[model samples]
Target: MRVIEAPSPNHEPRAAGVPLDTVVVHYTGMPTAAQAIDRLRDPAAKVSAHYLIETGGRVLRLVPEGRRAWHAGVACWQGLSDINSRSIGIELVNRGHAWGYHPFPESQLESLRVLLADILARYGIPPARVLGHSDVAPERKTDPGELFPWRTLAAHGLAVWPDPVQPPAETPPVAWFQARLAAVGYCTPQSGRLDDATAAVLAAFQRRFRPKAVTAAPDTGTAARLMGLTASA
Candidate 1:
């Protein structure tokens, strides 16, 4: 593979004794791939991903897979912390929501699949480990949003996809929904009330796993999907 040069200075050696087994995917969320690349390379920005896949499928390696890139900040997964040291980060190029967000190109996704397959095979990353920026940091971020083709990646065995069954028409109780979401590893509070934070987390979960319907409210369909995902995981 033709490797690109490092584009960011905000990285360091992986935390000692931390086993690397996760891969976090993200979108540049900038106006253009070039601009995103520049920002990642800027030391003052204090942020960088291991790889940046451009719209036409060009893959740029900003940081070595073995090092800790500053991609996932203040994140958590599966009760584990320090996600930066435990995951490989891939930043897909896209003008994100703030700058006229658009669908990721087919070529870019194909490249992502190929890269993810290779990474998974080499690192032995579990299906649940293949996640999004929002999955680890739901409160502060939403890049690689609902439009991301996670189902396509799942079809290629890169990630997990919840069942397509929609829940019954009558809305399930809030407690039932919160419990299911919490079971799925989301940072959902135990409170039965569906507050804004809960909605954000639910929306983030839907954006990653159940893209077809991502309403903030815990409808029957979202609840059912969350239950299926947790069970399968």
Candidate 2:
């Protein structure tokens, strides 16, 4: 793999032999890739990803894959609190939801697929481990939002996808839905009430796994999909 290092001074060594098992994908949310790169390389910014993929499909290495990049701040996954120590972070260039969020370009996605395939193969990261930033910090972040094409990634064996009809219309009640969300590693409460936090979690989940229609309410299709995904996982 040919690479050029644009080293950032914002990262450090992983907490001694922490096995890498996750891949956190994100968007720069800036107006341009150059600005994103500048921010990432700025020590004062205190943020950096191992790699950044520009809109034109250019991949820039900001930190060595073996080192822990300071990207996933205060995040968790499947009981693991120190996510940066166990994952490689990739920042894709996009305006993000805050600005004029748009679909990722074709060239960029193709490049992303190639990079992700290599990473998944070399590290043996599971399909379930390929996740979005929002999945790790649903309460505060939502980069690589609903516009990201997760289904395309899954089709190439880079991630997992829920059944097209798992949570049939005749499925059980809200408790069942809540349980499935929890099972899939979402920080959803089991209260059976679809409150704001619950809705945000559900939306984040959909944005990563579903990506077609991210509604707040747990409808028949959404419930079925969540149940199917949990069972598969």
Candidate 3:
């Protein structure tokens, strides 16, 4: 992917026998890409992704894929909590939710598609394991946010995306939603009731999948989409 080496000291060896089976996507969420790079290189900050894709289509390698870059803080996926040990993190340059979220440029997305293909092939990471930072840390994070063009990534075969859902005759029960999300690899609370934790997880799911109505208030489209996820995946 024609990466320019820009190593950061904020990384370490992955845990022994940790499978590199996942890829976590993130947006810088900072005011500028340069600022984001600066923070990532800052030792005290203790945060770094394996690579950063800039707005101008430049790719910077901050850490070797073999190491655990201090990303995915306090996160979990499926039943595994040591996410940083098992995944590769890619940071895209964008002023996410905090500063001013916007659509990624064509050049940036094109570069991302190429980079993702290389990483997926190198590690043999499955499409289902490709996730956003929000997916693994539902209650604590929402990055590579709703406007992040997940469907486009899916089109490139980087991940899965459900088709337009046919709203069901009746809304599926909350437990149904919980089961579907769990099956799709999210560490969702399978409580029969839609509690706060469940809702936040659903919101993270919606933010990536059914973004049109991300209220976390379960509806027919959301339910139908959930039902279709596994089949599509």
lDDT of 3 by residue, 93-149 (tens): 999999999988889989999999998998888888899999999998999889888
* Residue runs of model 2 more than 4 Å from their true location after superposition: 170-172
Root-mean-square deviation (CA) per prediction:
1.6, 1.7, 1.2
> In candidate 1, which residue pairs clash?
7-41
List the pairs of residues colliding in candidate 3.
Answer: none
Task: Please provide TM-scores, in order, for all candidate models, with all chains considered together.
Answer: 0.93, 0.93, 0.97
Better of 2 and 3 by TM-score: 3
The positional error of residue 79 in candidate 3, measured at the CA in angstroms, is 1.0
C-alpha local distance difference test of each model: 0.85, 0.85, 0.90
| Alpha-carbon runs more than 4 Å astray in model 3 | 163-165
Which residue runs of candidate 1 sit more than 4 Å off their true CA positions?
Answer: none
lDDT by residue (tens digit), candidate 1, 114-143: 899899999898777898989888888997
Pick by lDDT: which candidate is best?
3
Q: Which 10 residues in a row give candidate 3 its minimum summed lDDT?
A: 224-233
Ranking by lDDT: 3, 1, 2
